[model samples]
Target chain A: MSLQLLFDALSLGGIYAIAALGIALIFGVMQLVNFAHGQFIACAVFALILPSSQAVAELGLGRLPTPLLIPVILGFGAALALLAEAAVFRPLRNAAPVALMVASFALGVALQNLLLVIYGSRPKAVSLWAGLGHPVQIGGAQVPLLQLLVIGAVALILAGLALMLKHSRIGLEMRAAAQDFGMARLLGVRANRVISGAFALSGALAAVVALVMVAQTGVADVRMGGQIMLIAFIATVLGGMGSLAGAVAAGFAIGAASALLQMALPAEARPFRDAFLYGLVILVLLFRPQGLFAPAGAKPRV
Target chain B: MLSQHTIRRRMAASTPLVLALGLLAFVLLATTMGDRATARMATETLIRVTLVAGFWIFVGNSGVVSFGHAAFACVGAYVSAWLTLKPAMKGTLLPGLPDLIAAADWPALPAVLTGGALAALLALVSGAAILRLSGIAASIATFAFLAMVNTIWANWTPVTGGTSSVVGLDRYVTPWVALGWAVAALIAASLYGLSASGLALRATREDEVAASASGIDRYRHRLLAYVLSAFFCGVGGALMGHFIGVINPDAYYLNLTFLMLAMLVVGGIGSLSGAVAGVLALSLAVEGLVRMEKGVTLGATTFALPAGSQEIIIAAAMILVLIFRPAGLLAGREITLPARWVTGRGTTHNGPATDRRET
Candidate 1:
């Protein structure tokens, strides 16, 4: 029982923690909060659903192997990011911080209403689990194949992100910009391109999480973005608000703890899981105010 | 030069009060007649207007948009309701009080004041922790506070009745009652606007370093104004709760918060008059143009309105206002009157065109 629950927690935490890294990158690059970041998840969910629609079977992709769907999903995620940056964030550049923040909220509301109108406010799935099969029953435990896939994807994404941030030119530019915008500009780095790149990466990450979430639950709803965004926000804040490493760690801790609490508590107490997560964030923020692991000399700015 | 400027300022400032009282009289007489429909219309907006005005007291002063006013209002509503509905204090709901003070049941006016006081207390307590953070951090922390309160309210079933709507209050919100409170809030907000505290607040908001250097205590003043703002907000919440007769915890959540925020932003961030204007405009929009989506004969084109059109209109308005009138209609920088139009108390010369050079 313990092993099965632990595995479930790990898979869920890994996906959330991976997605949160994208959010952390944007915050690190630009001091903007980008409240509309969650909509990427919504867009991803919709994109993935197209392949699984009953119409997809009619169109002949239903019989296609799972390997073909993987590349399509990755492409869909990246596209979602690029589209959002062009449609929303780019226009908000010259405005005051407060105005930009309001724009993020307006963008969020617009996306949500649009999704409801287009998708009809019903839950959907990327595809029917016709060939995915049920949970694999191991000697004394049960591990779902989808859950294992999610874990592997999260691991690969995290490793890829870690390497890219450590070695890539864009990553170095992002770090420089975060350190000092004026200095980065003086150093002849193209700050605007870097910021857009960060937003694109964040959106892609959220899309990946969306795809994982749909596959694991086998259901997607318009409201799913708000839920995931709320958690990602809490995770980011608890992990010191701007550090990618902090966001991932916080996401993993929050996700695992919430899952553990859900299992530990009785049926009547399950709904309190999110409330518990929020409460934990509040407590940490009030007490520490700077997060658990921020270095001693870290400034308040990104 | 300074003395003449002072005299002119004193004379100019009193004009708004006289005009406000006149507007109040007209408004009162305009809505006095009619049945339940008229009564609801007249009284319905008073609380909302009052709440927005209360919000301006802090927001206008600090220049930090707070997302937690709803939580304070929630606290006020719950506290006042619990008090007014107590078995001892409520004559209808609670027929008698404790053995020591069974007849201590208060009336509508005092009960409203009591609600405001409790809200102020809640503000003081919360502000101690909240006001320390500045800008976005402060705003987000308040959101967390709202979430926290919602959690507690949703779970504390025995006290809040938990998720279920609280009902059964005497509907004593006549036009006079609401107008009386609304007038009081407007006066208080306007009064605070011209006060030294207001000066300190504006100074801090407009220029923090300069204000601090000028020997103003920024943090303490901000907190005081916030608490004061919360007091009036509490009154508005109680009035809203009592008038509506049935308010659930969800009613005071983010939706209402957003509406209040929209009201402030649309009116003009730091303008008390603008806040009032915003409430009036929004109320009218929600009631009028928003409903006119079916058909408004615009020349010859009978444009079929799309579904969920109100969101689109409001969102457009918000975007437009942000782009064109970022400081709102009467931002902190109002046109300085030349005093030629001042006749005793009526300085009724509509503010001249915007100062293009100010920015």
Candidate 2:
């Protein structure tokens, strides 16, 4: 039982960590909180299936074999992100953080409504890697094979991201830009290159999250990404705004806490679990407004 | 004999008065001349005006984008519903309400005020902790507060009716009543914008370090604006409940939050006039789109936009507006009398057209 809970927590946390990383990357390079990131996730999911109001979603691009399908989805996500950057974000690059945030929100609304127009307002079932749902016994706990794969995928992505950030030229520039964008630009790091790279990377992560979510739920709804996006947003802030490691750790911590709360709470109080969780978030903010993992230098100057 | 300072102050003051009169004329025209549907739209627009203006009282002055004001509205709506619903109705619908509330019946007027007061009280408590943070952290805290409120309201089944709608509200908020509230909101927002606390708050917004250095308490002023802002939001929420004759937790959630925020931002987040203008402009545009979706007869054929296209178009319009004029349509300027009209023709007025005090 304990092992099963652990896997559940890890899998859920991995999804949030990926989403939070996507949000944190753009926020690191630019101060804007990309509210449209949710739509990006939803768009990627819907791209897998054909546009129809039918109960069973017909496979569109999803019909491709796994090896080909993964790259297609990632590319689509990156292209979408690039298009949004060029159209909406580029023009408002110099606006206030609040203005940028609002613009992103408007973009998200437009995208979500567009999806609604195409797909209709109903959940559609799609069977992708249906065999992966089979239970695998490990240490006397029955866990789905997909849970282990999700964990493995998240670990691989994190490792790859970390290695790239540590070594590659674009990666180093991204780190420098994240730390201090203006300073990095002054030191010859290309602003457009770094921002675009961040957007593309963020979009790919969103696509990965979409794949994982669809594999788990086997259903795609227009509203699917909204809840996870909200939770990921909270995790991004809790982990500290621009701190990548912090975001992942905080995401895992929240998932663990949520899973534990589900087990611990009385039946009557279980429905209010999110209230307790969000209340705890406010308390955490009160005590550490700079975030739990933010570097000392990141603190706002009086 | 008016000094230049007095003349400018009066001119500045006329902005809100003119806005109020404009709303009043709209309400009168709609209620008197137009059909029932027109009156309903006008009433709804005025309620939005009240909400947006109330929201501006905090956001415009403190320069803090709060995602939590809709939660306050939700609270006010529920609270008013608790007080005004028939006693037998409450017993059946919300059996968990304390005997004092469940047994007593109240008139709409006092109940609405009570709702606002309770929401203000909630803000007072929440803002104390939330105001301590600054910048995006504060904004995140507000978002968390909103989530917590939403969760509680959505799940507190016995008292809140969970996700179900509470129906049979009195619908006392006619166009004129909504106009009264809207005009009152505009006046209150304008007064707050010009008050010492508002100025101090805006000072903090512009340059926090400098403002704090000048003996201004940023937290105190922010909390003051927050409480005041929530009061009006609560009132707006109560009025909305009465106007629609139904209240649901979902109605006051993210959709309302985004709608209010969109209106505020599109109108220019800097000025009171911008808030009112944004609401009116967007509301009218949305109404026209809704009508178009219902089909419009032109000559030989009837044409109509597809359903849900209005939301997409409006969002696209917002993006275009932001791209073209980042500061919003009015660009933080109040709709005051022209400088030449005020100063007389001979001297060319060289002062900036924008409201310097706001931005």
Worst 10 residues of 2 chain B by lDDT: B350-359
Q: In candidate 2, what are the lDDT values of residues B234-260, reduced to their tens digit?
A: 999999999999999989987788889
Candidate 1 regions exceeding 4 Å error are A1-5, A46-84, A120-144, A260-270, A295-302, B1-44, B81-107, B155-158, B161-164, B193-198, B203-218, B293-307, B334-359
Error of 2 at B127 (Å): 1.8
Q: What is the lDDT of residue B71 in candidate 2?
A: 97
Please write out the lDDT profile of model 1 over residues A1-302, one tens digit for every residue: 98788777888788778767767787777666666667768766766544332322222332345677656666666776666666655666566666666656666666666666555555754454444446887667898887777778888888998788789998788888777767898998897788878877787787678767766666667777766776776677667767788889988888788888888878866656677766666667767766655544454332
Q: DockQ of each candidate's interface versus the true one?
A: 0.29, 0.65
Q: Candidate 1 lDDT, tens digit per residue, B188-287?
A: 8777877898889889887777888899988798888889999988888888888887767788876677778877887788677677767767776765
**What clash pairs does model 1 have?**
B88-B96, B88-B97
Give the number of the best model, judged by TM-score.
2
Instruction: Give per-residue CA lDDT, model 2, range A1-302, as digits (tens).
Output: 89889998998888889999999999989988888999999999999999987999999999999999999999999989988999999998888888788888889888888998888888999999899999999999999999999999999999999999999999999999988888999999999999999999999999999999899999999888777877788888889888888989988988888888888899999999988888777788788877778855576566
